[model samples]
Target: MPLLAADNLSLERGGRQLFRDLSFKVFPGQLVQIEGANGAGKTSLIRILAGLSRYGYEGRVSRSGAMLYLGHHSAVKALLTPRENLAWHVSGEADFSDRDIEHALARVGLYGYEDVPSHALSAGQHRRVNLARLYLSQSPLWILDEPYTAIDVTGVGELETLFAQHARAGGAVLLTSHQAMAVDYPVSRLDLTAGIAS
Candidate 1:
């Protein structure tokens, strides 16, 4: 069964129609990438699919299971440490233990900076702290918007590997990234420009 599906989605902003009659499905074990040029409504569509934007859009989005969504912003609090951020995530997806949070932070290359204030971290580091949620998430579906924005080359490679691993483990991922993905796994493309999913 598909983990998520969008039906007959249409959106208009500033008197411009971004897309119309757009539909797609993301099944388990599949990695889907949203492809489009700037101002093509990629982020807008992601927000719709992630249920972050409920108004001003004509669409029906359905999800069969839990999902983890990481948007364009890192969504980290500068006053909080990396450890605290994960422990008290605004999403309230799960109650993570100290060990679990620590392990996830280490996986994202924030091992020793776990307790450092986020304000002291670099932009990439802040993104790493947000990306750490991927390691800790048990959700079957992951929806990400521009996840590679502030990541380094090595970190990008790691994320690609992680996405592949998730697909192989019967999970699904839908993400938008300007950078081309370099991975062994097959990646399905949903080109908003053409309104095609293949």
Candidate 2:
């Protein structure tokens, strides 16, 4: 079976239809990019992919347990330390020790900023803190919407390296971005507007 599949999917927001009858599939080692102009339902589509919009769409999504979803805004809490912020949202079912958290922090370029409240950090540092969770998530499917919003060039390169590593490990990613990316790895893109025009 494909790692994840969406068939005849539809999503609406504010009582307006965002997208309809969309079908797609993602398999192991594949990175699926959803490209569209702003307000073309990218966020809504990801919400359904993440299972956060259960009743807002009519479709079938087949996926296994290892799915992680990140939205446009960094979910990291401003009042908490980076370590504490991750601890709150990541699963209690999974056990990640202090070492794991520390390593994750370091990997995302937040090495010395781990203990500081996120509000004290710069925008890029805050984004790195948000991305640190990916190191420990261990999910096979990563669905990110505008994941590049707040990071610096170094952090973006780090993220691309990490994404390449994940795909090498048979993981899958579905993401949206406004900035053009040159991925050195294999990637397939689904142009939503093209589908609509056709």
**TM agreement with the true structure for every prediction:** 0.96, 0.90
Q: Could you give candidate 2's per-residue lDDT for residues 127-169 as a string of tens digits?
A: 7777887888778899998888878777778788788889899
- The digit string of per-residue lDDT tens for model 1 on 60-129 reads 9999999899989998999999999888773487767798999999998999999999999999999999
Candidate 1 matches the true fold with a TM-score of 0.96
Worst 10 residues of 2 by lDDT: 189-198
**Among all candidates shown, the one with the greatest TM-score:** 1
Off by over 4 Å in 1: none
